[model samples]
Target: MPSPADTLTSDEPVGPQLATPPAISIQDLRIDYGSHLAVDNMSVDIERGVIYGLVGPNGAGKTSTFKALASLLKPTLGKIYLNGHDIVTHQRLAQANIGYMPDMAPVASDLKVWEFLDMFAGAHGLSGKEKSTRIDECIALVDLHSEYHAMCTSLSRGMMQRLVLAKTLLHRPSLLILDEPASGMDIKSRVGLRNILRNICKSHGATVLISSHILPELTEMCDEIGILHKGHLLDSGPVHDVLHRMTGLLPEIKIRLAEPPDMHWKEWLLAQEYVSNILGEDATHFSFHFEGEESDLAELLRRMITQGYLACRVSERQRSLEEILLDLEYDGH
Candidate 1:
């Protein structure tokens, strides 16, 4: 298997330029529905030409934040900027550079796929030849050429999603905000959607903010991730950096034995001075949850060796986004 570092360069173009301003920026944003706060004071910046994963549990305000960014919902407080234009003060300009897909399909079911995209292209000011060219480009971009003449209602869920994406891309927006783009998609459709998104961000220099409940899937596609919980921005940064920061207090060490250790081994692990919990266990394997400075990991390993237990494999475990979110929610209380 290739290392994470190996995957890093796969998506980046050779000699890709750097130093572009953020494509999306949010500062101390807040939103409310009646007396209930749906989005707390949150802030994040998304760089140009990168795919960012906006993740949270249901009711974590993921939809609310996306709506505000798309200018569909007016925020009660805070500001949103897209491609350097303030969304609130410069609504049209900000919106012009954004293509937003809501959590639900917004297509006219009776319209054919091509007509649906053409309608949006016209609305975005495409003229006779320009409209035809842009519509063809979008259809090819989403790999929907075969379904161009199919009625929206006759299309499968996944095809409808692709058509909607084609509609969103009609104006060639620099930034795309997709809220649960894979909600009702099958495995094949989801894979197709992800591939289309990856191509857009990689080949076209477009930035994307995609929200999803599937952590593993997001981890595979996103360049960075922002985790939200209970209306709070728990963490935001490069995926690995955020995971490292969140798990800094707990060391993830895995141990392998020559043979299956006895129950005494579990007791001995828990009794260690720095160890807090035994997170996972299996035959010939165990994971330790250690607290305090990471430098103590060496000392813990030395002690384990000195204790006469044959430790075959010992290494820190990588924290998952789900684990970080759980810790954040529990820690705040």
Candidate 2:
């Protein structure tokens, strides 16, 4: 398969996040439909001022969990706390602390973008100059200043999604819970969403919990990630650590010879036990899977140098989050 070189893939742009008390805490969370359980005994802790991605397949209960958090669905058992308030008991306060944007957002064709934001701002108790000021701030926050006065119905799908996001942020929520926010967005729109969310986490220090089928974008946008499957939380941690522990994934390594080697380099590599799934036989670059001892790679490098291969560079390449997650599914995890 051709690699997604044009896709945004990085853990660097989001920057450093220090550990803090849990902004979101759940214990023994369960949601059931009659006798059917959508989520069972799933628990997770999302830190303050961090963007946590909840990744899973369609039936993995991602949306169910989000609904429970937003107070739209009551849990059968267990507790969820948002910014220190219990969601069940202090429902109104918890809801106030959270800004939830579901997969489908409601935007009126009759009103302009700012008017829609103004309506929500007033509903949230903002009035007079404060409401107007906050509306403008939110419009700018979502990078919708150019369309500030435009009719909401005339916007593109991406712009409409962004407008909904501005409305969600108008109340200055302490926690943001978004489900499939980029569902119908273009590549440029997806990248723009990534940047906006990252800035929100860094500058505003708000806790965010988001899920998207766009795994590649999640890798670039989130500070931590939780993988859920069949209503179970498989793993959760910082992106780099989760990527490393993603099903004992073997990282691919490439060895580049200074020149086309006429010697027996291919034969030597093929003979190695850990060097399986070799990709190419080109004289310049040889790539293979390496799951052996880390020390073995050093030994292999020395041997290659001694064999007159003139090793110019040896580097490791990891598969993307999507690749690793696919393997995880095939393995029934």
> What CA RMSD would you report for each candidate?
8.9, 10.0
Clash pairs (backbone) in predicted model 2: none
> Which candidate leads in lDDT?
2
Model 1 C-alpha lDDT per residue in residues 1-333, reported as the tens digit of each score = 223433334344322134554798788899999999999999888889989998876688999999999998999998887876668766776776789999776679788888887788878888899899989988887777888788888887777777788888888778999988877777877787789888888888999999986677888888998888878998888888877776766667787887776668778878887887685566888777777565677777777778876788887777787776666556653
lDDT values for all models? 0.80, 0.82
The runs of at least 3 residues in candidate 1 whose Cα sits more than 4 Å from the true structure, single-residue gaps closed, are: 1-20, 247-252, 258-270, 276-283, 307-310, 322-333
Quote each prediction's TM-score. 0.83, 0.84
Candidate 2 Cα errors over 4 Å, as ranges: 1-20, 247-249, 306-310, 328-333
